[model samples]
Target: MDIHYRADIKGGLLILHPAMGIVISGKVTIGKNLTLVGGNVIGFSTGINNPFIIGNNCSLGANAVIIGPIILEDEIKIGASACVIKNCINKGVTLVGVPAKEINKA
Candidate 1:
């Protein structure tokens, strides 16, 4: 797992299991209690300077990819192999599929 020096883990009880293959950019800001599975990629987009901001209690499934300057609100659940390119402002929901759309309100 490559978590850049500038990346901040603001919350407690964060878990990065099998941390291998997880790439987090320095410009990212992660909230508390995050559980990231293997093969997760959280970073910026091409030519974009803004950083990715992840809210608290988020769970990213295996092989999930979240790129670009986006905001993931609290309690967001990303499904396996999901790709999130936009901001997931809706809290307490499960997002799935390519370009990840909210599947369940939860």
Candidate 2:
């Protein structure tokens, strides 16, 4: 796995699937129990040093991409192949689809 992350992760990080290409930027701040399924990319595409913040107990599904300047609050679930370019600050919300809209709140 080519996991390249130069950031701060507060607690545990779990990658569920056995795959390659995990890229996280240096400007990211991840909290506890960051459960990731399969390959994911968390970075800013604009080349600006925008901070990507993932709160505690968050789960990202396989092949998820978070292209930010965005903040995800605690206990959020991102579905497979979701592309989140905006912020999801509501805690315990489930996000899915290409632009990753909120499906429901848990």
lDDT (Cα, tens digit) per residue for candidate 2, span 6-101: 788887988877565577777788999998887888876676665679999998888988887788999999998999988898999999999999
RMSD of each: 1.6, 1.6
Error of model 1, residue 106, in angstroms: 1.5
- Number of the top-ranking candidate, with TM-score as the measure: 1
**Clash counts for the predictions, in order:** 1, 0
Candidate 1, residue 32: how far the Cα is off, in Å: 0.5
Candidate 1 clash pair list: 11-32
**What RMSD does model 2 have?**
1.6
lDDT score at residue 58, model 1, on the 0-100 scale: 92
The estimated TM-scores of all candidates read: 0.89, 0.89
Candidate 2, poorest ten consecutive residues by summed lDDT: 43-52
- Give the per-residue Cα lDDT of candidate 1 at 25: 80
Q: What is the C-alpha lDDT of each candidate?
A: 0.85, 0.85
